[model samples]
Target: MLERQSTVGSAPIGSFVALGDSFTEGLGDEAPDGALLGWADRLADLLARRSPVPFRYANLAVRGRLIDEILEEQVPQVAELTPDLVSFCAGGNDILRLGSSVDRIAERFEEAVVELSSHAKTVLVFTGFDPRGTPVLRRLRGKIATYTAHIHAIADRHGCLVVDLWSMKALQHPRAWSDDRLHLSSEGHRQVALRAAGVLGLRPTRSAPATHALQGRVRQPQRLDDLRWAKEHFLPWLGQHLLGRASDEVLEPKRPQLLPL
Candidate 1:
């Protein structure tokens, strides 16, 4: 169980900008209007409550974005928004591809970090969550671990805070992820928000929820679920790559501008 039992304290964040791909965009954590309200938004709400001045936020995350793309497209926006805080969680999509090099990805990631550190007062980065408990993603756990180590080293070198998702125990549970086993769920997003707030030295206004929940054994056949996931989620994603079409190519960022909450 996690514990966060304090109102928005004296943490001095005023504006924040989030950059990366689906996770930062809140893909699995859908809102009522069919929009995703992922962790960055949750953390922004917390910051808004804690800060003495008006807090503004922008999320430039688009689904299926690569780290290089973020560096090329998103990082430049930091100079304009000039938010006091910036969160960078990328390279997962890059890692998922075949022939992807962890070292190369981390190098590009660090480049963005260097640029971000110069622009924002507080630069925040997230390590990839542990995937050992996941069947499909576990094979890439080694790569994830390697990248995470680089993330920590980069954070240390650049004087940035980290939201070490690799160590979050609660995310191991099924509920923390969506059906695809890639993105985090709503509760997972909440957990991430709580962790990010802690990293920024902010206090939550409420208690933290238990990391694990009791999800009774499923009666449905496992093979059926796997087939469905492959058909509904995996195939289309793979098809996009085969056709050289990026999912977010036509879509604009969910929150393009930094605005008051």
Candidate 2:
């Protein structure tokens, strides 16, 4: 875990904005209303509880966004909000690309962080988690580690607080992940929200139900199950890359404006 900076003390936050791709957008953390209620939302709820005054929040994230796309589309909007705090988690999609350059992605990501940091009182960044149990994603663990290192370096240089997802052992469990094996399940998002609250020096007012109780025994995936996932998710992802397309090509930001929560 990165040390909490003195810049953002254990005080109540006024406003917050979240920026990134699917993870930040809360892809696998679906609600009964068919809406995404990701970690960002849960974190915002925690912030709201900690604050005595009105708390405003916004989430400017979309699925399948690359580092550059986040820089180009979300940064300006988030900068305009000038929230008390901002959490950024991007570049995972970029790292998954075949010929993506880790160095370039880091450079662009740092630029976005720098820009957002100037506007917000504090900026929070995240390191990607190791997808060890997932079949195909496990193979890209090396690349994920490399990108996570770059993220740490960038956060250090900019004096940003980091939520070190890479070091979280709880996420290594298969139950923490969704069927897609890429995004976190609702329980996983809740755990992340609790950790984020801890980083911000706040105790969660409410606790999320334990994942073990909600998710029963998780058996090792069968060979056929792996093949089915490859056909359904991996192959389509590859096709999108080959065609220079993204899943969120026609999608809009989940929360475009800062509003009271």
Query: Which candidate should be chosen as best, given TM-score against the real structure?
Result: 2
Segments in model 1 whose C-alpha atoms lie over 4 Å from true places: 1-11, 204-207, 212-224, 241-243, 247-249
Off by over 4 Å in 2: 1-7, 204-220, 241-243, 246-249
| Model 2 poorest ten-residue lDDT run | 1-10
Whole-model Cα lDDT of every candidate shown, in order: 0.82, 0.83
Please, what are the lDDT tens digits per residue for candidate 1 over residues 1-261? 223422223446778899989899998999988978999999888777656777789999988788888998999999988888899999998887888999999999989998998888888899998988665667889999999999999999998889999988777777778887668889889889988888877654565755445233323327777678778877787668534665655867989999998
- How far residue 210's Cα lies from its native spot in candidate 2, in Å, is 1.9
Which numbered prediction scores highest in lDDT against the true structure? 2
Worst 10 residues of 1 by lDDT: 1-10
lDDT of 1 at 237: 72
Error of 2 at 34 (Å): 0.8
- Candidate 2 RMSD to the real structure: 3.7
lDDT of model 2 at position 107? 88
Q: What are the root-mean-square deviations of the candidates from the true structure over C-alphas?
A: 3.4, 3.7
